[model samples]
Target chain A: MGGFLAGVVGACAEAWQEVRIHKGRVLLSLIGVAVAVCALSGAVAMSAIAQQATIEQADSAGGRAATLTMSMQPSDSTATGRQQATQAWFDVLDRYEISYASRVFWGSSRVQFPDSVQEAGMTVVDQPYGEMHRTRMVEGSWFQPGDSARLAPVVVINTPFWESLGSPDLATHPTVTIDGLGGAKAVIIGVYGTSSWDTWPSMFMLTGHFESLLDPVQAAGSMPQYEMWVPPDLARELQTRIQAELSGAVGAQGFVSVDRSDWGAQMDDPTTILRVITMVIGGIILLLGALSLVNIALVTVRQRIREIGIRRSFGATSGRVFFAVMMESVVATVVAGIVGVILAVLLVQSPMVSELVSFGGISDVPPFPASAAVFGLVVATVVGALAGLIPAIIAVRVKVIDAIRY
Target chain B: MSLIELTAVTRTVLIPDADPLTILDGVSLRVEPGERVSIVGRSGSGKSTLLNLLGMLDLPTTGELSFEGESVPAMKPGRRDRVRGSNVGFIFQQFNLLDGRTALENVTMPLLYARGPRFWGRERIAADILDRVGLGHRLSALPGSLSGGEQQRVAIARALVRQPKLILADEPTGALDVETGQSVMTLLDEIVREENAALVTITHDPAIAARSDRHFRLDRGVLTVAEGAARNAGRADEPVTDGPVADDAVAVL
Candidate 1:
């Protein structure tokens, strides 16, 4: 054991000496390994963070909630009449004790504020707990039951609508005019933030106020869309009850849409796909790094052929020669890996990188875990061993007689 | 007992695009402990080949070679390495000191290879040997930084560090000028005498050969000793010059 330790120490010393002698070459090799490792770690951390954000968004959007939507049909006899269809669906939900909200979609038209006029789509809701009103509000207050009677067509605008109106002070009293079949008199009451329908301008108003603006014929002809949000325990029961009752109601189209919240389901997911891709790319980079290491080791062995023979002649066994060369490679790789990981962390943790990624909805860069560090070390060591194998064998294979002769 | 013995040893070489070459044929010789012997021959006369065989770096194709009554041909590579380390030390013509290491490090290398607690103080042992060889001031210098004579002295220090029973020098001073070569030979002779170790020096220089206790000539695989020279000479024996051929007559026995 002592001899083995000595051999290792001697080998390390000898390798360090050689590296010092050719400092430029050693530095260049280390740089190559460092760059490769940095790229690998950065890509891995980015992918992990992106996937995590996606899952969080999906969970917040109610991945498991069940919902039912009802729309009135204009072209049917008594069975498809718009008012009758909405009442039929409400009755079914009430019978089943299913929690639900009704939304009446007014047609898309221009909304006018004091300084600006913008195209907006308006959806009328009965309560704040309804699906559309459940959107997170960035500023101002939500509507109450008396807001429909006390205020004249009060509106809750999204960020885009608020921004288009030159960021008006909606906290005091703000009014927006909506141009429907009736003249534009809609008022901005509140400002809210939402991840849904991010590309378009939109606003929300109380269902009673919106109904007051519509003529009896237009209100009867316009379909009142209803959305039923059911808890997991009552979801199937509510869906079945609503479907049965609404099939026979006037103006009922056989359920215009049935959906649960899936806001980020399609856009974001975390799985083995990114990991596999990273592994492949990282594996290729690692392979190239190993090849270069082997090339360097082979050159070193060739340059030291005479020295190897002299050592062997003095009493070094073939095993000792092999071990000496392998140790050099392992030391080089391990040092390079450590440097690479540090560089990667610096890059990912930088304010610039974090800020740039946050614009794309990712706020944090995940840390390189201990498992990753261990993996990097193991990869470096294995690559070093593989790279040194040929050179170590060559060193031992040198004939003592021929070496002396040379 | 003879420290080195070779009987009917033959070494052959097979080369591509050519007939097989016989480097050494049935060469038989023996050197007892504390003896100094020189093998002299022209280039390609197999003198170095004989030295290699004696150094245990190469194997004989036929017959038996022994070191201190143990057969060398039957030794495994590991055993052979042990024997080479413990029993025989070598100095080469080119002074093969590792270029990356300091003179002291090179000298200590053999002791480092020696398997025992004795190797623990190898640095001190190496420094002592270097001091004895007049290289105490050059211990920290690399081979490339030293002159040829200084490098050869370092090599000699390395060979002596193990305290081996026999020293095999293959044209140790062959690359040096005549004056430097003679000085190196004198230093070797003094060191060998001081250590009480046998020395087998292979050289083509008759002047260097004349300084040894016994001088033999090799020609076309045959080793012949000088005729009138005594087989064993006392420390005070005078140099003999009955011509080089006189060495062959003594070996006829």
Candidate 2:
């Protein structure tokens, strides 16, 4: 055991010396390896960033993982039929002990923006919806507990809508009049960036306030829908139970169909696809890098044939010769891998890249993943081992009597 | 037991679609520890082939060969390699020192595979050997920058650093001038004696062969006793009495 360890240490030291002596050759070959590793690691890191951005984009659209969105279409368009559906939603929420339930009502209204009224789209949601969608307020804040007590309904408007409202400051409690069923007046509670919205002049308000603005004729068609944030593990169970109960309440098996698809699953589609594509690309780049290393290693072994012969004559075993040659490549590539990983971290995790990827939508860009870095280094070492194997065997086959040759 | 023994050793090379070429036939020799022996041959005389057989670099086609009473031909190739590495050291005609390594590193090569204290104290052992070879000041010098004599001295130091039981020198001083060759041989002789190791030198120079304790000559793949130690004190001033052969008779084996 001791002799084996000594042989290994000696081979490593000899390899390091060879690397030092042949710096020009080592540098030329290592440049290829470094660039290849950089490309692979960079692709991996960029994919991770893209995956994060995709998840965030998906979160803003339908919701994050474990978010079960239930949509019901009633065959009977009667007022009692829709009311029964809404009552079924409430009963399900109550029975399941849901703490983050929100009734969402999508509609449009004419807003009086101090000078003129402009038609705009509005989303009515409860407080949990703000937390669920990870909405950030640029001015004032999302709905507070006291907001429910105010006689006047409060609303959140995006920057474009705020600008359409003459950009009034929320500290003064600006009021925008909505020309709906009763022409209700609403106080502007907060302003948000328009990142999450696909359309300009978008607004958000409480579901109760939105329902109150509706008359009997409009209320028959546009009922407030419910979205509840549930734990990821229990989402499927809750979805099945909710579907079963709603079907039972409506007294028809296929009368009401619940859209229980989690948007998080949809988000994973792009991530998984990107991951596969990136791995294929990185693998090709790494193979090219290995080829380059193997070419240089073969040349190096050929050049050192006489030296190997001399060493063999002076008590070097074939194993020692093999190890010395092979370790030279391994050590060189491992160093190059570390360099490439550091460069990748700097390039991918930089604020400029994060800003470019986020594009004013995703605020929290994750740190450069350690798994990608580890993968790069591990692959580099494996590539070195594989690339150096053939050449090392050739080196070991050099005849000891070749020392007699010039 | 003798340090080396070979009986009825026959070596032949079979070229494809050609008759088998016999290099050595029915050759036998024995070498004891601490003895100095020399084999003189004209060029193409199969001296290196015989050296390879003695050095365990090549197996005999037919022979009863043993090193320290162990059957060498019967050992596995890996075991034979280990035995060769541990028990024999070689000196080449061209002073085949690795180009990039310093004298100390070149001398330390043998100890790298050794176990125990030799592996740990390799540098010290190499340095001490270099100092003994009068190359202590040249330890850091690469072989390219050294003089021929200094390079040969470094090779000698490398060979003896492991303290092997046998030393095989194939035209050890063939590339050097007469003065440098004599000095190298003198140093090799002193060291082999000091280490109590056996020495086998294969040379084409009659003057060199005359200085060994026992001398043999090889001609047409046949070996025959030449002379006893006619000049044991190794007077380098002696003139060659034998006429030179026209052809360079030492065929590379």
Using lDDT as the measure, which candidate wins?
2
For candidate 1, write residues A185-220 as lDDT tens digits: 666667776554485778877777777877776666
Q: Per-residue CA lDDT of candidate 2, range B1-253, in tens? A: 8898877778898999999998887677788898888887777778888998898887788977899999988987777877888889889888888888899988888888677899899999999999999999988999999999999999998888889999999998899999989988999999999999999999877667766777776766766665333543244333322322212111110
Interface RMSDs of all predictions? 2.3, 1.4
lDDT of 2 at A400: 71
Which segments of model 1 are wrong by more than 4 Å?
A53-114, A119-271, A354-359, B17-19, B111-125, B227-253
Top DockQ: which candidate number? 2
Worst 10 residues of 1 chain B by lDDT: B232-241
DockQ-based class of model 1: acceptable
For residues B11-106, what per-residue lDDT tens digits would candidate 1 score against the true structure? Answer: 899999998889887788888899999877678989888988998888899978998999998898888887887878889999998876899989
For candidate 2, what is the lDDT?
Answer: 0.80
lDDT of 1 at B113: 66
What range of 10 consecutive residues in model 1 chain A has the weakest lDDT sum? A356-365
For residue A99, model 2's alpha carbon misses the true position, in angstroms, by: 1.3
Please give, for residues A130-173, the per-residue lDDT of candidate 2 as tens digits: 77776757888889856766778999988888887778878899
